[model samples]
Target: MIRKRTLRHFIVFVSVSGPICIVLFHQTSTRSFLKDSCMCNCAMDSEGRSWFSQRYKPSANVTLNRKNGLLDFHTYWWWKSLQNESVVANYTQVVEVMFSLFPDKDHYTDSSPSRCRTCAVVGNSGNLVGSRYGALIDSQDFVIRMNEGPTKGFERDVGSKTTHRVIYPESAVDMGVTTHLVLLPFKILDLQWLISIFTTKHIDLTYMYVKPSIIADRNMVMILHPAFIKYVYDSWLQGHGEYPSTGFISVIFALHVCDEVSVFGFGPTKDGVWDHYFEDFKSDPNEGPHDGDFEGKVISQLHQKHRIMLYKGW
Candidate 1:
């Protein structure tokens, strides 16, 4: 099992308190776009740099207060984001209060130039019905599962081991003590929710009503840096989707922390349907804020560049 020291988060400024908008994935069926997804176009960016470049900062995480309580002002831009009604006044105070309970430590101390920590980022695409990828997935040094994707009976295809589970207030579940409950705090209220969940259990509303508490290891909880989310949105997807999907963000996250990453349950299914493994949809899957087509292209670029080995489940 991989042990975590400090897990800080995504830079979120406001709360999505109004509504949780569901953007049905708009499929891009153009041949040119499909080819782009297949080809290793490393020059997709204007700078003409490869996604596999060592220049990419793995420590996208911002350490607000260092060992001596010194602040990194340069990373302060992380708090800039799409504002909403529930804007926070003193960001530092709110952050420090949250850190008072959750320790502020860098999780990558286990990282080394000599070490190779492989990770398996499991998605919930329906194509994994019978691929039998369980053994391969569990064999990795880290197994990252996102949202509510289950591994109980489907272990034969999706694997049962989970080192981390990335979720938001609405998507949260009863996680095991061993697995890291990575929180996607898109707003200040989200952070408040994190603190409340473990202590007072006072928070029970966001864009939708949420569980005040969940089963998780307080020590192992991690937060996704909002800057990291912004980074993926701007750099990787080129501002395509309203924001990056948890699955896409998980892949980018793996690239930053893991030495060798093998992605499973990405892209469309064998039937070309964009859906999850646990649910049954009669027609096309409901759309979300993410641009499913653009995300696919970027993933294809990463796959072609040899940066990641994408396992499009059968």
Candidate 2:
């Protein structure tokens, strides 16, 4: 009896410790890998220039003038007060470089002309299943969709009228008729992937990475500077949050790209409902890993606070 008890305890200990040990080892390995993998934490500005140090020293808070290649100021004042643990300086720089690479319409206040007045951002969440927002969606002058946005499933809830599909090369859908394909990438790797999806002959179908690109082609690719992403990260996301999901990014893109916009199939309703039109309408009380209920609550709050019209109707 004594031997059996001792053996049972040992078995239980090994079972628990085995997985825990593996997890800790994997995490430590990843940390070490991240430390060594790339010297430049993020892509450089459009100029493809960057300053980075392997040591976790404070980054100098500075502003750069892209056109004339000038620096306004340099200091560590902005980040000195904050806890470095909560700061992902590398991630922040990555976003900043992405913004610098893109054009800023607000910066060109004198030249920034309004191209979109009425716009609609459509998501493929299950909420759009039965609600017939088709005609209402079609009435909008501009419509933007993100990854895997299907028009067939909730054909009634989210209309078939897609003016533009903003996607990485992997997510580009077949836009048969007048719909346009907007490519968003300055990196050669990203462009290589895009070329594979869109045939080389159709390369002209691509758009510019800036406002001048927009003017050059009224149907130019709309690229938001990574700085705007930094703004959203710092302000709306509270700093440590995950990058905005594709759907949320689409909304922000529309906000800057248009004046009047209505959001469709965004968040979950009051009843803890989380179903996408494409998925079965039956609600599984058991929340899954990808549960949207928590996100739904935040989206609801943002809608109320921002006065953005959210379609919660059936």
- Each candidate: what lDDT? 0.71, 0.49
Best by lDDT: 1
Question: Candidate 2: which stretches are off by over 4 Å?
Answer: 1-116, 184-188, 199-220, 269-273, 280-298
Error in Å for residue 227 of model 1 = 1.6
> How would you encode candidate 1's per-residue C-alpha lDDT over 101-207 as one tens digit per residue?
77677665565434567889999888887889999999998999988999998999999999999898889988879998888766667777888999999989876
Q: Please provide, for model 2 over 166-224, each residue's C-alpha lDDT reduced to its tens digit, 9 standing for 90 to 100.
A: 66544555555466455533232333333333333242232323111111222333443
Output the number of the TM-score-best candidate: 1
Candidate 1 segments exceeding 4 Å error: 1-51, 62-83, 87-89, 282-286
Q: List the residue pairs that clash in candidate 2.
A: 98-226, 99-225, 99-226, 99-227, 125-276, 126-275, 126-276, 126-277
